[model samples]
Target: MITAPITLSQALDRVARERPQAQAFVAPGERHDWRAMREQSQRIARALHAAGVRHGDHVGVLLGNSGVWVQIFYACAMLGAVTVPVNTRFKTEELEFCLKQSNVKVLLTADIFLGIDFLELLTQVEPALASAGGLPGERLPCLRQVVVLGERCPAGAQAWDAFLAAGDAVDDAQLQACIEAVAPDDVLLIQYTSGTTSFPKGVMLTHANMLTNAWAVAQRIGVSADDRYFSIRPYFHVAGTTLSILVSLMTGCCLLTLPKFDVADALQMLDAERCTLTSGNDTIFLMLMGHPDFDRSRIHLRGGWAAAGPQVMQKIRDVMGVPGMCNAYGQSEASPNITLSSFDDPFSLRAAGWALPHPGMQVRIVDPGTGSPVPVGEAGEIQARGWSVMKGYYNMPEATARALGADGWLSTGDLGEMDADGRMRMVGRLKDMFRVGGENVAPAEVEEVLHAHPAVRMAQVVGVPDARLGEVPAAFVLLKDGQDSTAAELTAWCKSRCANYKVPRYVAVVDSFENIGMTGSSKVQKNKLRAHAVALFGLEQPA
Candidate 1:
């Protein structure tokens, strides 16, 4: 096995030198081999350097899944600059807040995508971008440049082509100096975890933290240079950047990226590329296998990965023919990989949502308040200690102190239980647990039961305020296309399968749930769901 690259720039350089002709990235209009990817990154590095971005400086990026996104990331590596991947779905307030909080010096964004003009949006967010030279102020003092990744750049933005051209004068010696100054332990990426709360915390992951976790994930999947992956996970998330993109680069595998997932298109791409591996959240897999045109015979899916309820993971393996699919679980703070179930694991272990822990990671199920280990087979907050743990939350010292302990264990804020066999099962998120008449209801457990219904494509359970019970479980469900089921019927199904109190008292069968309210890892924003449920039910907000 090739040793992991110490710095991300080294990963690009080493791969380019060793496999110059191997395909590194595959997209609809653009394809780059290892050498070409490295060269493009150099041009981007020059462009960024010319834009006045320097080592340790934060360069914010807002774009969809594209080759340009990958190019910008590596460009930051080439200059020891920090890459802050902003969620493309951000609105005016969120965009302004993230740029200001991260102290972004340069922002690389798309001119037009998904029918929204991003340059116009930026102007609305900062207002300073209305001029040829963006106004500097307390809100965005460090922000000096905004580079648009398209033609006809806005007044305050640099055109994509012009940005590349400006890099022509940057000498190799200057670039080398920047790259050499980087170390394995230096912060490489600041990935913000999207929360229902107004402010999202920027998780600071060093090169070592991300690369080591990526290496472990690659090892578990047994990826190789010969592998071809149909990648659809959003590039803004760690699931996309660290697991999918970094794994492809680490193993010299070819990755075909879909800017947005289309079931038919994804299937066609899988067959066209003869992809050996693919991965996404449970919802993505459900959409793929549940598609009317889905056929197991049409594609090559040797293996893949999923982080969902065990039943969903089982369906992914059984239905998609990737029987070797692994189960992964973690939060963004741990470079997003805590435990990954191996393909060779026993059905009991895999089904229980436990696999061998990633190397160098220490996990424990401790009482949330006492910080003491819970008895085996008992649920508690999961804590992690290792290289993968993020350094801290950027500019949020109080939040960081609350998250990470002086003992080096980072409280994951997730609830799980480890069995005597050393396998662990995720119960649910601590915050998502609701009590109906003083009985604890883990929303995930109920959602798992709801998923068992053949007609249910997606299900989210939230707590609604109650004058009598303090709170009652309410479900917002999305049914499969061309399938029919009513709230009454689904409520009956749940009541039949679970305890009386666990069954949702209220069910709303909606055409579609709010996808924006979900986190990148496919977790439902229960807080948002709860608020929606409360409003829909006309219940008074708890004082």
Candidate 2:
């Protein structure tokens, strides 16, 4: 029987007691067994306590995926402090917004990682931090201490060693008391949304919310203590926090961490470590399979999950030799996992992109216009209510009210369809849907058809202004290696496969959307694609 953990501290302690000597975390040159994980995280908790972090206090973690990140996360949990993860891809403005909005008291960051200098970025955010000796300025008044991990510690920031030693005087009994005070309903994380359409909002999640959701995912994926899980998801994202890190901790599985995603390094690590499970999006899976170094025989993967369409899911099973791969669907506000196909599910259902809702989550497809539940097999907005729903958006009551109803159902603002058996499949975002001479068209539905093309590797579609039709579909495509397709031919292919209104009126062949329309998590930014399409096609901006 799978007993769900209420608090993260309880989960950590349970796993530590059950698998004392088993490996819990593994990276290139580092390893932390279950016993060490408990000890190390407790030590960090002591240090954080000495730094004056208390229950409900917000602490920011600005580092890559490493043992240190895991230790810090658990330490904050031990103290009942909320963790606000700073995205590595954030610029000066974005980083400052996160720190200021979350009211972070202490920040732990790295000097340099993957050729990016975090110190330089921090200096841009606050010029006085370089000379104020960890003192806060007007811009960041709540920030009391800046802890630097690398050798080049700034003038005002505390060094890693000194920070760790600061809590040597803190007793174990005091730390235990703090841990005991933590409740299941206490907010543990304030995850920021990806901001594809608007400024990012902080999604407040409690211990019970994330822990139960992670347990559901682990159960569905058949995760066990013996499984070696390889995940390239960034630690800053909710998927990394709940699905990867928390899942491994709860299941006593060994988590394989990568500071950054590189095709060569990922391929080599998967083969060498004999990883049994993995996770990624459609773009990530495509990049791995398209790489010349990818050898199916060398890969020992048995099962995993993906946020992909039917075309990509089919390739993951048939081409990549992962027959147990399942399709996944969710957003940050739902603790990320609303529905996921079980590893034991039939391949046909998995390939068709059908997924069963997490055991405790209640899912409904509702009309975006009237808030009425849609019939099964009809497309509508996806809303969920249960243990996985977020508490609210932090400090944004109006936005919170808009997303969450009084009855506790969260309006996901995503388009999807459900079948008679309670299986769900994502269609597209409600905001991404475009009207074509009165007919509604979902870009995802059209993009899926484009993905079926032999030469097309990836496709992104947007609604561009048309004089005759108000708006029409425009597509940007990335072709497979050594393959060629013109705009006209691709348009013809889509025209033959889709309805007249659904087919893209204009198609542009592109080499890559790397920095142009991609997010840090590999999701396409449809809003940006729309802006780009207008400029490239010389379409007039809507009034």
Candidate 3:
């Protein structure tokens, strides 16, 4: 079946026209019907176009996961502009790198978030933009304007409402025309991968790519208009952006959003809203388990089993009173989810599950050395071919080519085994990366965070063996001349900056790091570091 090319905004309009009085977006005390959301998105689109944003132009959204995030995403879709959502946890330097790399012309952000003033950071980075002044605004090179969301507009930033006043009101006809102009192959969003290095690579996702993934998820989760989706993941990530926001909009489901993840608050919302379907990374599941109000009676899954350890699963059933749970697996490069355990399968809760049977999506296990397909029940590299595969990394052709083969299959770089029953069990990563409590703790991502410490001159991170978690991050640091900071101090600093799981469990101060081998780019060889961590921490062999 050939699906029609429907831009995100068009999807919202359809829902509004069909379910005008139906509740759409819910957050705190705020609620918007489908019709209201559609009109607001149109107004925002007009406001964006008036600020000089156009088709294919990058519009940076640096806000948290709030109702405004949905507005910005749909508004950009309505205008055919590519949205670039930046991670809210990023430091000033990290934020600057993403903004400069994407060549974002317009930025929409909040004045303050998590006790940090984003406006002050923007001002500090403004002078550095002088090096690249070919774009319209010399002040920020490609950045021509900034829209401050919420009530207070920061100094040197334009009020969001003021910008909306200059543009003509947009109607359904205008939105429909814009949707007609948007081809399925057009780039929809530039999602930045949380790479370990100083710079992040933008994963270019096409409209078809995202739509296919969302459709697959809807099918797996049995999404419908009656489903209420609680969006706890950050909108900057694929899990929240495509799976939560885009999927809800496309499937005509109601979306409940949270600006931040708070276990107590989330439980209250789930109970009050009676959320039927909730999805997030493993960390979210763990957080839910920790809440005092966590009980199976509070949750109502449609047909899937909630994935967790047996003890956690029992708690969910006993406390929240949910019947079933299922495990899900995917990566940013795969537009997020490729496989989900089924509620009907006997081992569904134990395994990562099976790939959804979407059109043009294929999964195979191949021996890494010989590039030959591995037999069933044997571990090998997991490769996939699907409409959900990303178009490529933005402006990084070499990396793109290496990731996606000429045969159209994308090597996931993840090692897994397919059982006789066709269920896939992930073994480990072909790369040196490892997961810390379900989050992809790339040694590089942690190492970069360590290097940011004022007392540290250089640092390296690697996954070490853990008794409970499969692996935990460990760090080796070299202090600057005459500077001294205890391992506890450094670890505490990282905790303040990044997620808790990303903090190093063990730290050591080293005088020098032996350069065993260097890449063509002169980056330190991470394999050597991994080996050292294994030797020092005595990592256990995989059974």
Which candidate has the highest TM-score of all?
2
| Per-model TM against the reference | 0.96, 0.97, 0.76
Give the alpha carbon lDDT tens digit for every residue of 151-215 in model 2: 99988899999999998889989999999999999999999988778779999999988888888
Count steric clashes of candidate 3: 16
Off by over 4 Å in 3: 1-5, 128-140, 150-155, 169-176, 196-198, 300-320, 347-357, 432-543
Q: Give the TM-score comparing model 1 with the true structure, all chains together.
A: 0.96
Q: After superposition, how far is residue 387 of candidate 1 from its true place, in Å?
A: 0.4
Error of 1 at 303 (Å): 1.8
lDDT of 3 by residue, 1-543 (tens): 126545565567778889988888899768988888888877888888777788899999988777778888888887788999988767778787888888898989888887778777776677432223322444457887777876766455687778888667655576557656777778889999765433678998877778767866776666788888886767888877888887777788898877777778888888789888776533355457545576656665543333233333443444445544556667778886767665454543433344443455678899878779989988788888877788888888998998899998888887777877666755556786678767776564566567556576566677777878888888888776667999899999889988989899988887655443322112345666666777776677556
Per-residue lDDT tens digits of candidate 1, residues 58-145?
Answer: 9998888888799899999888899999887788888888998898999998888777788888887777777766656446788888
TM-score of 2: 0.97
lDDT, candidate 1, equals 0.84
Q: Cα-based RMSD of the predictions, in order?
A: 1.8, 1.4, 10.3
Model 3 C-alpha RMSD to native = 10.3
What candidate 1 gets wrong by more than 4 Å, as runs, is 1-5, 135-138, 520-523
Q: Judged by lDDT against the true structure, how good is candidate 2?
A: 0.90
